[model samples]
Target: MSAVPLATPTVPRKRRSEAELKAIVDDFNATLAADPEHEPTADEVAAWAAFHFDGTLAVACSMADAVLPHVVSRFAPGVDVLFLETGYHFSDTIVTRDIVAEDLPITLVNVMPELTVAEQDEKFGPRLYERDPALCCQMRKVEPLARTLPLYEAWVTGVRRDEGPTRADTPLVTWDAKNGLVKINPLAAWSFDELLAYAGEHRVEVNSLLSDGYPSIGCEPCTRRVEPGEDPRAGRWAGFAKTECGLHT
Candidate 1:
């Protein structure tokens, strides 16, 4: 009897084809669309995502002022929250980062540009943002995000449809073919007013810059206080041809 040992059984691995994955997203979207009266909670959405893509995905919370709380609550503590720490951010933005770290259940992953600020300055001179905005963004924003994205199976963003043309087509769940990962925008349908209302109702701490007319905060060299009639994101990368940090684009 000792001559033959029992063979171990192997569990079959599940491999989802592109169409199957798309079907999952599409079905979820259809569910949400059909149940328009019943707004899905953050927990519900997170649970569904976790169930479908368990052990194969990571949540990338952006920690933006509007959707940070929702993302934090949806994903458990120590989940990766990616921040593009461009080193050119304002002191206030840094303060906000610390505040978020203390208050939320998040593991902050600071994604920095390959080039040091000093190195960049030496190569392109100080205030390179003033000269070539696209190149500056490429070094500061795009490159860092591109480097960090490959480390995860999925990423979560704080984009909302009301943010305007740039984010209007944001889906609740979609494939990022370029990055080869799933991109989830849980709060895609929420408006700025709705976001603020949720924050107020939940007692979420927001960045101080928001109160000072800096609606969309970014690198210190490019951000400014927007006028009353201007768009919320107008303050970021002002006077530059850049609208987004290349994350959405």
Candidate 2:
């Protein structure tokens, strides 16, 4: 089958007021709550995002898979995809990112931290993630994203409820109080198997680590392999008490 042409986005930059954003969030959350069992089709999810955020919609891809960007490109081609390049990813992660950028119609924006790994190590001592994973994540992931998130009114993520207990209540759409912006998780109801199935069905690019037992890929130093029956995220910060990289928490 021939690939569909990406639609050209014509919506101008339209930043909403605080009250307007709040109203949208409230209404959207209520709608989801009313139909808790309802899982919107990818096309429907893309349509809703286009209707609400329009040109300001950005997809947050972990480079674990290109599923989210593939869905977004149908409605908003050339949309910004926020990729946090924490300077600690595996070679496969970077390769996956490049593959997605080349294959997808979206724009890949590499969000970087204020300091390099060398600078950070020099300032905070070596291997911060080992000593304080939360603070390391704050410096590399959370802080950088928080700075760049203001450019877009709404951001979409690949987070799923089945990933872990902390993410069990993942919503399709909600107000991100931490970043003070509208957050969208279209695949919140999807399971790990569903994600892989979608990728296979759509021929989306997936990280190589997934087949190697790293269900949830993060930085090389912080991420490890998970054994059978372990939570998908168990490999992340394995020894530490940190389940999340603070991007979602």
Candidate 3:
């Protein structure tokens, strides 16, 4: 039999302890509480995150657009942008991500689940999303992000207050106890009109689905088209009781 290859050793990166991180979170939350209505500019938010978590900061993008990555890169060039490769994305979403990676100044890191799609199907049975979207999302999106987020002290997200009722009260900066990291929502106060204007001004790449009646895009199987008057997020998880895939909450 052929000799088994030796396992590659990994040098652990220095990370803040739970106590230290909790202290920082408490301080930051105090500051946020004092000025609860303070809405910092996107650039200012980026600067604050970079100042505190310079070497251990990351941005999580849903691949719906490159707007957040574009804004963060202004302050932290070459920073890591994590994309959850759930193996169920639309073709346009993947293309948008690839284009952003090729054209932008940031490093695109494709975070993936432990099992491949076929393996998951074999283990959990086919059409897992149809039968149990929450479980599928837990294995594909939530668990993968949980595994990857430990490497960073802070992360930026693209959530906006205008998205829907569920995200209406999104904070600019908050501690994510579930993932044990500081979460930053720089565009928490931005409107859809503002987002579009910024994208036009910056010439940022957006997924084609946005123009096809899908203002909020997710995994293809659960997404559908929405009417003009409906909520932007209504297209996601259509006819289901699921509002989110458990990434934010």
Clashes of each: 0, 0, 0
Q: Write the per-residue lDDT of candidate 1 for residues 159-215, one digit (tens) a residue.
A: 777775788887777888877667777778778777778778877766777778876
For residues 1-249, write the lDDT of model 3, one tens digit per residue. 111112110223588887777777677678778987875788888888878777788888988888999999888887788888889999999899889888888877888898899999999999899999999999999998898888788889999999999999998888888998889999999998888889999999989988888889999998999898999988888878888999998
Q: Give the TM-score of candidate 2.
A: 0.92
Error of 1 at 80 (Å): 0.5
- All candidates in order of lDDT, best leading: 2, 3, 1
TM-scores, all candidates, are 0.82, 0.92, 0.91
Q: How close is candidate 3 to the true structure, as a TM-score?
A: 0.91
User: In model 1, where do residues sit more than 4 Å from their true spots?
Assistant: 1-23, 30-43, 54-63, 69-72
Top model number, TM-score: 2
Quality of model 2 by C-alpha lDDT: 0.85
lDDT of 2 at 197: 98
